[model samples]
Target: MLYAYLLSVVRTVAPIAAGWLITQALRLGVTIEPGPVESLVTGAFAALYYAAFRFAELKLSPRLGWLLGWARPPEYPRT
Candidate 1:
């Protein structure tokens, strides 16, 4: 659980960090001052991108591995 939590944190932070770095680099060549709304939009987009990537990763990986197997499967009672 802790490993999964850490992985999630890393995934969530990485894109934001990269975006910040890219914006800083662009600042050297261009005068771009983003407003609060623009920053919020950018952050939301980054979070969506991370979620999509994580979905793809979960779809690709096997279900019976050590990472996923740590969680117990849901039990649905018969109707």
Candidate 2:
């Protein structure tokens, strides 16, 4: 479903954004290929961002559910 695809994309935002920032910072005033350190730090930052956003969405659904891939709470069926 498109919703699932959207969630997948949303989930990557944190890692991608963090990687970009890290790359830029690492490249400052020097030229060097990315290494394990960059990757490890980026991964950690991504995980933190993902957890925080998901927590916020959980605690404040409907208001911030779209932050990082929330399936949205189920709705009751009307009779």
Candidate 3:
């Protein structure tokens, strides 16, 4: 549980970094002005993208093994 919780923090921050990257690309390639509204839309879209993938990796496909940021699986003791 703790492993997942820690991994979840990485998952949460990844979207923000991706959002900034996307926003920079748009600013360079497209003529759209960088403002609050543009940032807001990019942030929402990045969040959605992360949510979709996270859901698929964790819920839809469990066998893929840490497609996100998880370095390894958690270890559990057996009796």
> Of the candidates shown, which would achieve the greatest lDDT relative to the real structure?
2
The TM-score obtained by model 3 is 0.37
lDDT of each: 0.66, 0.73, 0.72
TM per candidate comes to: 0.39, 0.41, 0.37
lDDT of 1 by residue, 14-60 (tens): 98999898798778896556686699789889878755655554575
lDDT of 2 at 22: 68
Model 2, position 48, has a per-residue lDDT of 91
- State which candidate, 1 or 3, has the greater lDDT: 3
Q: Give the per-residue lDDT digits (tens) of candidate 3, residues 1-79.
A: 7777787999989979987987898889965566977887988898787667677766667544465556344466643
Ten contiguous residues minimizing lDDT sum, candidate 1? 64-73
For candidate 2, what is the TM-score? 0.41
In the range 1-79, model 2's lDDT, one tens digit per residue, is 6776787898889779987986887789555567966987898899799778777776766656566656674465543
Once superposed on the true structure, which residue ranges of model 1 sit more than 4 Å away at CA?
30-79
lDDT score for residue 63 of model 3: 47
Candidate 3 CA-lDDT value: 0.72
Q: Sorted on lDDT, highest at the top, how do the candidates line up?
A: 2, 3, 1
Give the Å shift of residue 2 in candidate 1: 0.6
**At residue 31, what lDDT does model 2 achieve?**
53
Q: By TM-score, who's the top model here?
A: 2
Model 3 pairs whose backbones collide: none
